[model samples]
Target: MPPVTLKDVAQHAGVSHQTVSNVLNGHPHIRPTTKERVLASIAALDYYPNQAAKALREARTTTVCCVFYGHNPEDISDPYRNLVQSAFIAEAQAHGYSITTAFVNDDADLTQLRQRFLQREFGGAVIVGTVLTPSQVHTFQAWEMPVVLFDHALPSTTNVTADYPEGMAALVQHHVLQGRRRLALIIPEQDLGSTSIRRREGFLQTCARAGVEGAVYDGTWSYDAGYRAMQALWAGESRPDAVLGGNDRIGAGALRAAHDLGLRVPEDVSISGFDDFEFAQFTTPSLTTVHIPHGDMARQAVRGLISLIDGTESESRVFPLSLVVRESA
Candidate 1:
């Protein structure tokens, strides 16, 4: 039997040989429709690139790492994290790359990660879930290994993040337009990532500009946290006219707390949240929140890393955040 070649795949896909080559090399300029046709044709024809010849030409691995901080595989449950990881895996696979997931939480793990990086076991890496310190990021930059920082920004690394500050500002403006003063925020307990910082800054700055009194309650990124924070906020001398949750989980928790306290949401007090998680709409009276494009972010991050690995310059991008209006707010 004859081995399938790039020419065979190109003929099968009805594209030029160079197009097939571009697809195999993960060229960023190819149209998605054309790329899809080429990929499908390759799979249909069971065409596999000549590994040795390819290595002789590029001499680089096709394995990319998705590095997460503060959590291991068995304990991972955040919806956003799960979505982005899945997207990254799919996108990497589409680009003829394999993805390996790793967890780094402390100095020991960081040391191990650096060692693996120095060994050139990964072609590139995507930093997700937690923001690394500036020095740590600089170390990666010094290694000349392509690194994409998701949801965070470092001076020397490629960063991809949603416009969280803009979303927060818009949400606050919406609350003000609704005639809701005395705004309150339910912030997550830990500054888990850069998203938290952006949201906090956006809320504070927007509230100040709007001349709306605001209060903040620290909590975790969970329903229980939202509930507890809401309880604390309401137990004060006066309750907030409008409450903004850090995320849907916290918002859902806050909604339950409000219901338990006999307060009517959007009537007694309006409530809003972020992330637009799956359950955001199902909660009683639903939830109004910001929608972050998880899939898009993941795709861009993977592509950016791939471009970097190919010795092509990849620029940082910030995805615009959009508000999803529902019943809660």
Candidate 2:
């Protein structure tokens, strides 16, 4: 079927397209009955305004796409993503641009995304929160529009990311200060993505310099995986004295697993996590974590992506990470 246009909406509402536009623009002169008719027609037609023209006739209203990715639908709904998204939207609107959000979970979803982008009215897109696998990188390279990868670094693309290794170094040294001689990192399986590699590099390098043992454990980025990894580590004869969770969710799970095993945190094993998620402070012991400045990241990334869209080059940005020490570790 052909794409629905403003004319379709006007026809469905039995009004002129000008009347539909007036109602959409909130002209205030239109009667309540006319506005309701237009809205109902829009819903019935499944009509989406040309995003660049959505509710604004001004030339400043550039529509930018924000694409979020995850391993699954649930992961896409993660709080971390929400943090970034809220910030991203606010920052975009600050510069007079309209924002639309999209999700890409796996390669299969790429087809739908491609269809939208092919006919898209947007100028540029900001792809954030996704693990940039090689295939993903390759696929993104094919896109003709400007894109900025947020929190995930891609040598082939402009990136606005965090200093993960630096963050991990701070975390590791904190553990070492408490006389922790052995450390282990529980994170998602290794990938070429900057988050995974930089985190490991920081943990291992810091541990080696501190003359402490640091091991890496692989798992899904989920609470269940963290729980199982912790259980397996405890089952071993020589488990690390300090456990570092890749993110707060994993750390929360590890904390629970330790409690269930009748082990006292910090007494048996000290734990730390990343991403100072809201739940971090509310955890039983209150999780110690590294804070990713989601707002700052969003601000920087949106500015950078928009710059690139305006025929200017934007260098990648890396924001420093901070550690929030709490009772957890």
For each candidate, the alpha-carbon lDDT, in order, equals 0.84, 0.81
Tell me how candidate 2 scores on lDDT. 0.81
| lDDT at residue 52 of model 2 (Cα atoms) | 53
Model 1 ranges with Cα > 4 A deviation? 1-58, 72-74, 189-192
Would you estimate the TM-scores of all the predictions? 0.79, 0.77
C-alpha RMSD in Å of predicted model 1 compared with the true structure: 14.1
Per-residue alpha-carbon lDDT of candidate 1 for residues 1-329, written as tens digits (9 for 90 to 100): 77678799899999999998887665889997887788778767756566444353345888899998666567566787788999999999999999988888765455546545544567779988555788877766765668999988767678998989999999999999999989989986468568888899899999999999977788877789899988888899987899999999899989999999999989999999899878888999899999988899999999999999999999999999999999988
- Specify the poorest-scoring 10-residue window by lDDT in model 2: 52-61
lDDT of 2 at 293: 90
Best by TM-score: 1
Q: Which pairs of residues have clashing backbones in candidate 2?
A: none
Q: Pick the candidate with the highest lDDT.
A: 1
